[model samples]
Target: MKVPFSPPFIDQDVINEVLSTLESGWITSGPKVKALEEEVCKLTSVSHTVCVNSWTSGAILVLKWFGVKEGDEVIVPAYTYSATALAVIHCGATPVMVDINEDFTVDTSKIEQAITNKTKVIMPVDIAGWPCDYDAINELVNAPSRIKVFNPESEKQKQLGRILVISDAAHSIGATYKGLQSGNLTDITIFSFHAVKNITTAEGGAICLNLPESFNNDEEYKLMKLFTLNGQNKDAFTKSQAGGWKYDILFAGLKVNMPDICAAIGLAQIRKYNDLLLVERERVARRYQNFFSQYSFFQLPILEDKERKSCFHLYALRINSISEEKRDLIIESVTKTGVSVNVHFIPMPMLTVFKDRGYKIEDFPIAYDNYSREISLPIYPQLTDDEVDYICTAILTSYKKVIQSND
Candidate 1:
């Protein structure tokens, strides 16, 4: 009856794949990584795809690729992980935090208000695996000129009037909104292959390039490759060529390339990944919804009327009719039953770094409110039907014990 949240669903196939990769004697960012990247491109319909060590590296690399420098601001949702905001800071850019819609995707309405001149990138996080209003976002990001800066003599000297749209598709790797996949919906997208994700590469990610018309994909991808590989103009494979070892350093780049060992696992996962993994996840989610839908305390997730199919990475249960104290009590109760639960995120501004940056919690009431009452239960491909039932019953029992007492 013990159910752990998001235990990776690795089978013998994934294990055998990695073991064979070890035996192959070519491990560091080689053919396997390229094959996986090509597979990702085929799945997501992205022009170019680059593999990195983690989702955080993919996100920051996107900003770095587009030349997001000091004094620039990148728009982000206040509800996402610290890595999302921290990545912006890594690029010497300020994270312009925005609120989310009631359904938890980034609020499109609030974006215009936050965009001033220094805004270099508008990063819309696909929170809880549901994509945002991309059409609306695109219209705003494309319309008119709005690139204000600190000094009139800055990177405006480099690229002008061209703000980028980056999608944090970490949770929505297999998700689609309005029939378009998450990666293709935005200008650039980053997908996570962390242990807990739907498709895991142990700890890895892919940066999918869908750049604007002005930038050439070849040039952009070349820079992306150089940036991830110690800023060298030539990678190790190229340098190993007979009498072809000469190259130059473009910028002080970050070493965040994905290894072939991780890619091997992803390759196996991607091969038979469709329908089988997603269908099981949906079935589990539906069963959880059916069990909890009748209760006043339970507000099941909406997939925006079936036009959008969430990857169902999580089913975020919210006790909105209760206090934060009661929410904590519920978590404790769930824990006592040998079933583990998790919170998807804590609002970034509440963290020490954002607090030091003068970000107040009250600014993003929706995100804070959502975080307080939310609890994400185990919804992986490995959970058995009986186990799901046990977990659901445990949740209902906890809700009754904690919330009824408070009521």
Candidate 2:
């Protein structure tokens, strides 16, 4: 069996939705986008949500919305996808990289030391659909000493009164933290619906707004709608209406709005989320854990606990104490068996851009340790029970072969 890494769970219902949207003749950011935003709001229990072209766009939008620009600093984990830091760079702000804990989430304890007067945003990534310790991270951001260090710029920044916490929740949509969903866990959260994500809009994302009391979610939502549409005061659907043709460009903004076609896919996924996608993923993850727990070589991903629940996006299996070279060989072995696997991320500092910027991987030992030995298995909703078994057996065989040859 050829087991592939994450694939989008697209069904006839999703196809029908997209077809309906296409037939309706409003393919741009229209009613379907609005409907998808509403569904996300309900799923996350957040007051407002704005669908964007992608998670990268959503992150940059939030940073730009808060006026995080040149001279500002944003704290992000070195263990995450580059999008988390690239957003800061897009704003001409400095991204101060921090290390992560064993669970692959940001280390809350190390966050404070990264804070400076220039810090404006604290972006904690929810890697592999697992929510981070938001309460601890939020407390750190609001700590009196940390607040004293924040130098506000825009009115939104001043209103927030302290460093803003935004979750890079690209992999985590249905995941929960302290009985709250991923988006609600932080001041602002971005969810990706990329092809490989648990839910797919082909290439899309949403911004869940949970800012402090000083900010109005409704107004924020409207402003973000404008931000995503090239600052156009009205959308295509609105202008198509009677006497709505007259509109104006509010200001220069990014054209990152999600089209109705992509939103149609998201609408279908969110509706069947609990009933199908989330449950199937959990079953696959549990099965992997059951099979791998007996092996000394396998270090299982943190599946779930009392304080949190993962959406079971990726089963990031780690090879304990393995060097980077052996890990690569193991991956090669798995591929030789016709089973595809991948790394969750390469530590940001190891990348050429960050490395050239003077960041070092040695400073993030924990993140590097996690990255070097990690392999993400296929855990999409459509993987049959037979395929799951084949994937597990293939990995176990490959791992044993690699270890034996090394010895």
The most accurate candidate by lDDT is 2
Worst 10 contiguous positions by lDDT, candidate 2: 1-10
Residue 243 lDDT (model 2): 95
For candidate 2, the lDDT comes to: 0.91
Task: State each model's C-alpha RMSD to the native.
Answer: 2.2, 0.9
- List where candidate 1 sits over 4 angstroms from the true fold: 145-160, 241-247, 304-306
lDDT of 2 by residue, 19-97 (tens): 9998998898888998999999999999999999999999999999999999999999999999999989999999999
Q: What C-alpha lDDT, on a 0 to 100 scale, does residue 325 get in candidate 2?
A: 94
**lDDT per residue as tens, model 1, 147-254:** 433222334224434567888989888889888877899778999999999889999999888876756777778788888987988877677779878988878899
lDDT at residue 143 of model 2 (Cα atoms): 82
Model 2: which residue pairs collide? none
Counted clashes in each candidate structure: 1, 0
Residue 317, candidate 1: Cα error in Å is 1.5
